[model samples]
Target: MPPRPRRRPSDRTTRARLASVLALCLVAVGSTSTLPPASAHEGAADPAHAYYGILGANALDLTTLTGTGVTAVSLEVGWDRLEPQRGRVDPVYAAQVAGRAEQIRAAGLDVILDAGLQYPPSWVFDVGGDTRFVNQYGDVWQGQVGARVPDAVFNPRVRRAQNRYLHRLSAVLDDGPIAAIRVGGLWYNELHYPPATVGDHRNSLWAFSPTAQAQSPVPGYRPGQGTTEETAAFLTWYLEEINDYGMWQLRHYRRAFGWRPTLQLLLPGWGVRPGDVDKAVAGGLRGATRGELTGALNEGLDWAGLLPRAATVRGHNEAYTTWVDAADQGTDPVYESPVRHLVRLAEPLGLPVAGENTGTNSPEEMQRSVDRVHELGLTGLVWMNAAQLQDGRWATLDDYRRLLAP
Candidate 1:
């Protein structure tokens, strides 16, 4: 009898082997690509010589802020106030915003225009209902920071409307005081969905709109179906959606302003408990993260994708770090510190990293925060609100001013 022919591998087995090899090759390529080049920007920024910036119009008080040596200010430009009606912006409100930007510039301070999409007009709910995101529990996520917002970033209709608003804002402001635009009104002026607090009835996971579902890679996915695998997939998708929205705003800014003004993505700059993220995954990813989670594909900001889209990435974490230290929370210093991770994320992208004081840091914590910024050579430092500059806190602002002064 003829020798039996050798058994052939099944098509499925052959395909699996090929796929594994292909994945390994891709991983190798990706790993090599992310390595820092000669002369990374992370250590290039000198916090000692960095610009001292402040958030809000409190810095607009030129006499007081200038006296403290502030060089920049961040202004919150409200979307609802600017365009309360669809296809039309209130002339008075628009003028007020434009005037504010101009005044900040005339005062010889760099201005960062914070246009938060979270401040959508009321009509948005009615007109763009299809784009609104329904959470796993079949409830729409709304009333974020007291404003009703949809998962509008990825929605085509919403993006178009927002693009129009940005254009109008640019036309009115005329590129005078605008040094940068920090986009995002998600929650607390940072990125990510609403809180996934335990026992809360509201759903924190979003972008479950028909549009989002249609674009979703996961087929037949439903909310509240808590499974680790499914939750992980959703988290990955949601991060991409965030990246898309960020890139969208950057593009719109360029179109309107005829120049790519520095685009900043304000991040919490704190770390979320992995256990909390795990719980959120079980709760349909209720947009949970303690700080800027950037390592693996979990429920955190996708800094790998976002840092490239932004010219500047600012984190609000130093005060939290101070609180944790003061309270003896025993948090990991490296994990809690946004400077190390931000420098790592932004260095390859050549983006400047900035930090904001939470207005709660003690004098000692303030010094540590400034020291970290200086060590990392961060681009700038901004005090969160007016409180840091008022009363006896004037010395606090003055300290940062002198430290950051070139």
Candidate 2:
């Protein structure tokens, strides 16, 4: 889970961490160069068969996993953590990834790469043309950890360098028994812009880059302060720009891994709005959309425009939605899961949508996630941090076993 920013006093109960995501099947599973040929035979297991996923594999003694039917493990490819320098991946991080991959494969589980570009190296900050993402407050988000979200949409060199990093990292993995790779930018391995509530700034919009400002539909337009028509126009561009970033990564992922593995596009907790639904209708996606689009314009998420492109990416793709918000936020009016709405959008296009819980710390929370997963008929539910299962206080191993049992 991405760290939550301090909230404004008036922003009580709002799902401020829009980057925490809703969930997704997160990259479909297909016959890849690394996998055994038997998994691909006709009438064998479906190519997209894995349901359960664990995000942090190294944190746990994965060899102990069994009987809970955990099918997939997420390989964290944090850019800074992987590539401390520019030319190649940090060998230590690559070795850790490889070791964890072997543990996951030994447990008869699949592997998925949750590629995160949040923590760019020092050189990435100087890649090209003011490459760091600037929020509405002129706060250029940068750090060695999860702080540096790049303006890749505006800087082509940043995209090239990032993809080159991905290609290099993939080579280090050396085509192991991997099922999928979840491609994302911004934060938390999910494709989203920076959150709105970064240290009590409620009016956070991430379109202040030099090129973003130059390409603005309504120059000098602040969100919600402009005319309704101007807001819509700016928002359309904002969301489409984010979608363009998503598409660019998808193209890179295809080129990086070729047609061997499937891909998943992650959408954060931007609840779908009636306007989005109206657009969905206009675009012939569905009769309606689901959930109100919370932090939609601020987060630069245009689900109506983004989902179709993701579902059609290179044939086999999954709509990865995050369901932790609805479970965590409970009845909070501001937070919602677009799972049902995503189902409306994804199913019509034959796309498989799945989810992941931000964290299932307690039995109650785990049960809530499980209940929603069953209710929505999601492809599967991924437990975000497997290490949490070892702690006996919140949720024990048995608790996760019970909560996640198929």
Candidate 3:
């Protein structure tokens, strides 16, 4: 070939651009930045100690939570947020959520994801409708608290849809990189009343969904007319279903990441009895003989056996000292040491447990509650309402961090 004339600088510039474009393509195809390592509590050198966090940004100011030297971040994700419409997940929200998880992981902090089914979509309820009670606000002050019914939980069609939604969420987050997962929170609030009630209505809130009610396997059992035995059976089935769902998520996460994520149960209102231990014992088992019902209603359910492999079980004790102080009027010895009974109920579970909402606003209350938690060998404690952190009333975040330090 004949010698070619020298090319112009413009031709050289074009070649350089082509080379840069090829390099960018290769970088996008082959190279990937590794996600920061997750910091889980179970794998820590000191398993007994744990730093507490809050439920999403609502529980605490995000700015403060990140700056507080917290090792973990807990947040509640609602069903509505996960799947707003049928089979249509919001990619924007999902990306934002995943980004938050990635950010927490990047910061070398753990993330706890809490999910719940109590709140139904607004479309499920209507004014003067049979399922109006499904709405969060249903005339609280008046004697009429609405019907307290949501067709979604009980309806088979809705249940299937909800289950599918859960599966989609699992698929999205399984590889998104998070530490812990709390599959339940105040789960029984709408299912069962605070104290044991006689009617099946209280126990069958899940039946509010027509689809669930229709597909219910129990024969000859009307939704509201079912007896306590029938209700118990229904709850057993429901809880088993939920447990399976949780296990499915855990398995998916493990299959995707080759490591089991922490599982947790966030109980509503501490899951503890309010009055004296003897009174609670009696109240929990009204008609049954002594020793029939444990001091707490939850103790009667044998949750530990149902979800034996859960990594953590956190209770919410909003008024610990207030309840204890009120119960002090009794001369009964059982009332004097309610914490002892509380600890006894949780000891056999063999999993890390914590108090999510400690009612220790005062120094004395904080000290007493901390002493009781330590005496019981509980894992740790988390205070609700991060705004209180700056109040300087009880143990602040710094104080709790120090107390839980390894």
What are the runs in model 2 whose C-alpha is more than 4 Å off?
A: 1-50, 224-228, 276-293, 324-336, 403-406
Q: Who is ahead in TM-score, 1 or 3? A: 1
Better of 2 and 3 by lDDT: 2
Which residue pairs come into collision in candidate 3?
56-75, 151-208, 151-209, 154-212, 155-209, 155-211, 155-212, 156-211, 156-212, 270-316
Q: What's the true lDDT of residue 297 in model 1? A: 27
Of the candidates shown, which would achieve the greatest TM-score relative to the real structure?
2
RMSD of 2: 9.7
TM-score of 2: 0.78
Instruction: Compute each candidate's TM-score over C-alphas.
Output: 0.72, 0.78, 0.54
Ranked candidates (lDDT, high to low): 2, 1, 3
Model 2, residue 174: what's the lDDT?
Answer: 76
What is the Cα-based lDDT of residue 83 in candidate 1?
A: 84
Give a tens-digit lDDT track for model 2, residues 253-315: 888777766687777664443345334333332112222224454565666677788766774
Q: Where is model 1 more than 4 Å wrong at Cα?
A: 1-42, 58-60, 144-147, 175-177, 198-203, 222-232, 269-300, 308-336, 391-395, 401-406
